[model samples]
Target: MSAHAINDRRHGQTTLAHFFFAFVRGPCKLLSSGAWGERCRLAKFGGECIHSDFHICEDAGRMGNHVASELPKSCDVENLWLCERASVVMAKFSVLLFLREQWTVLVVTGTNVGLGFEAAVHLAKLKPKRLLLTTRDEAKCKQAKQDVEQCSVTNNIEAWPLELGSFDSVRKFADRIESEGFPINAFIANASIATFTYAKTQDGWETTLQVNYLSTALLSILMLPHLIKSTTASDTARLVIVASDAHFRANKLKGVANWPSILGKLNDEEYCTASVMKNRYELSKLLQVMFVREPASRLPNPTPVSVTSINPGFCHSRLTRSVESNLVMKLMVHVGKALLARTTEMGSRALMHPAVEPSERDRHGRYMSCVEVAEESDYALSEEGKEISRRLWEETIEILAKIDPRVNQIISQHLLAR
Candidate 1:
């Protein structure tokens, strides 16, 4: 059978969808059906072929007829078919993936720490036009910038100080980035506080809530303009929040109504006495997921900003060691860590994948674990949860409004800008 005859037969028997599936699954079937002759005819004419041989032929033709003649012998027809199909699929997907857009900048928080540091290092390899690495500690940010620069000379990475626990700090950081006049392509809310003590931040909010949830929400709102400015009709930017699986564990302790209040008082005691800190940490992580999903459902405008939450799996980090230090605690931590823990590099892989990989661009507003998008808790997406995140957003504005009306104004201005 000639290639044309085979295509006509297949076209008569199959739908376009089936053809696409077959094309992707096994283009060799197309080759075996004798599509190569039709492709060759197409190549001979002014038209083009969809197989890899066509591309090789075209490249060779660019050199000369002599080169073109040699290509048929030099290139394997089967491999060319596969490559052609792969290229076509990628090109079509890029229409939805936003891979061709330039000027997408990634803002990474807490870039100094274990997973954050590792993510920054890996993301640098992807060569985003600009990367903003923010942290509360200036020294740490500088070190992280140095490390990332060392790893890849191609990425334009810079450092800025951002203390998520304080509304003041978040505003200043956002202002600085906006002043730079760069649109944010992605934002990773990776900074978190896992203190055992029920401390209040300078802003007079619970330390856990302020740092892990409220501040990140505020920062996102403040940076919304920059994100929007960067997005095209064809492009959708992303916000990836690094949450944890611990939220599920904390939700299980729901029946103990007064447990949070009681634990708040005991937070200052030694590690042996402040076991409840584990629950506090878990609660904050839960809130982070809630904030992402809640806004995703209710945001008036799809906002061109896709919000995603990811659990990077367990990793052996300073944060993990901080909570489990004693012999028994260490033993349990060791077992869990060994079984579930990924290296900082592996843990950050999911994050970097979401941030830079074109494949994940369409998977917006989803919760992910180990690169697979997973379902979040029902409460996190419930109306009540949406209201909770809304209340947190409003209260955060009110608090910032009181501290510096200018800061609140700037944040509001940015959110509503453009």
Candidate 2:
């Protein structure tokens, strides 16, 4: 490291910027290439025309050894297509770096419309090698694929069918993904459903619990193995779980410390059959947060994967369609959409930030409240809270195992028996 970088670290402000440059420099060196002239690429493509954006010219070989001699210092050679892979392989060695080559394969659920669709549009601009757009309806997934591919000249965009309401269906979808042998870079758990009434899915769980949290948890576990296939040692595949700020509103978790019994208590037949699920959605969000926070500890040390939860905030999308069914509720949601809620596109920024950027290692198992890492609910802050999270994680694994023993096999292979 340079003395300037060491000194910058002491002060903190210049740390990431200095590290970023140094990180990129190491890989360019590996490619045995020198920086190019500012307009070198454009000069080849469009006859000496100049553009400020960094890009590569077709003929480095034609430039001969003069590549080093005719270079402009201001141009970033790191941005060239020539060094793309090397730079990507090395840039992530440091948590401070976010620069990466285009992801080879990425997955997004619930992409038919809403924040998932918005996030898909933004991701398309990055030009991932392949994009997996999933939804409950095959027709919707098809439309979403068209909508996403239209945003950029991306390579391959595929549509997959997923129904989160049934564990059996989730297991089948996950099994198909794992068996397909496609290298996955990131999995965006964006499929979620909200309900005002207490209803049970085919899996015999409350609708909100099954769809919003359990299905996401199961899909993430199944996808963990694929994420472990990152090409380089410095890199880790990302899991971006979209949650909501309503987590704080799950007052039922306040003062509860025993995690194993809590799910049972919440799932008691009498409780579901007799009660009106007023705060079920909020409770489900809280459970998702807990799952995100617990995965790191369960995974092997220096974890080969990074997990994070994102709150898109109170956004207006198809998510509001349920509330829209009631006249008064629809008016209130409409007002929220107009006056306070973020538009679907704007809210997708929450996923965009983590999806494209390499987050700080400290952020693993943390809640990303929008672009910032914000404090979680007080119910999640204590030592006992950690125990609760662990217990919930175990219960989730145990219960899901009864549904599919392969869940145990995957856990053992990736996180547990290692």
Candidate 3:
């Protein structure tokens, strides 16, 4: 969906391969053969390439941009659309093939619209035993269920109410799932918000902190027992937390380390100013990247659960609607989306890759982008960041334990068990 055709032959850049990198701007794999030839070599993703008529093929690892085939010399920007379409179709077909034989139950959060709704529709095509969708609004939840039902062949789709702002609501939803006693094969935490306005949830924490980080951690921790219980010899349950590329921008947290508590400092009102609010959403996602790293280390080796985070790659979504009141921010989002944004449907495919793709050990605790394992921010991989992540994890568990006694019990029974 982020495809663009660059045809400035006057600039000495006229090859189809050059246009390929301009189209996706990320890692891609060669999908099929084209009229140009059967010997198309893949270039290293994000690497400098010397294009030469698409004749020379070089072998890189299983990570790069995927092209169906080379374009003919006579073709120009008009044929680039075919290459884009082939890339999307191939991605869909690849994921669907892995999911065809699966019959597991899946739970996707934040499914009222955008990435969540689109992911639910694709997951339903797997004919899972049950597909559960969660939304903050009941009417919208019902409408989403109907929409996904119409697109999918399965009739077992059900919509549920979940508000990430309230710990009580999160508890009730988890309790209902526990009562149902259904084995969950995957739980996709896709619901999140971004705003320049500063507000707190009914539970007393900052709105973005509670909805995006605290409550998300709470729900996923609560669901661990169910996820682990559902794992089998050949199949493992997956926990996919929808994080973001914005986390790379959260490099201003140096002062917070000197504070008594990390989460405490983040929740303080003084830190919620206009300039700070601009980066708060990115900070919350940074915490999520840590969440993926820390607790995953606690789980035993060869564990049956796969915990991973993903960046949906800046889709044209309703996530920015809350910040539209600020004219400056509104203009920025308008320009950003126009320049670099994928459609909601294409963005959802990245979300679906982790939910259904077959992998157990190597994929665990990894950050995926463009449907492949990607490097985290430089800070997130540093020693200081790891230390901060450790403290944040400790504080998060302690707070969540107070909210629900089951937090500690689940950690002991599921995570700590040897």
Give the TM-score comparing model 2 with the true structure, all chains together. 0.73
On lDDT, who's better, 1 or 2?
Answer: 2
Cα lDDT, all candidates: 0.59, 0.65, 0.74
Candidate 1 residue 239 C-alpha distance from true site, Å: 1.2
> In candidate 2, which residue pairs get closer than 3 Å at backbone N, Cα or C atoms, i.e. clash?
none
Q: Compose the digit string of candidate 3's lDDT tens values, residues 276-351.
A: 8888888889899999987688888787799999877777899999998889878988987887776776677677
TM-score of each: 0.67, 0.73, 0.80
Q: Encode model 1's per-residue lDDT on 223-248: one tens digit a residue.
A: 66677677766556778899875665
Question: Top model by lDDT, which number?
Answer: 3
Ranking by lDDT: 3, 2, 1
* Residue pairs with backbone overlap in model 1: none
lDDT of 2 by residue, 222-313 (tens): 88888888635656678889987666656545445643376776765566542336567777887898899777667776777778887776
Task: Give me the displacement of residue 278 in model 3, in angstroms.
Answer: 0.9
Q: How should the candidates be ordered by TM-score, best one leading?
A: 3, 2, 1
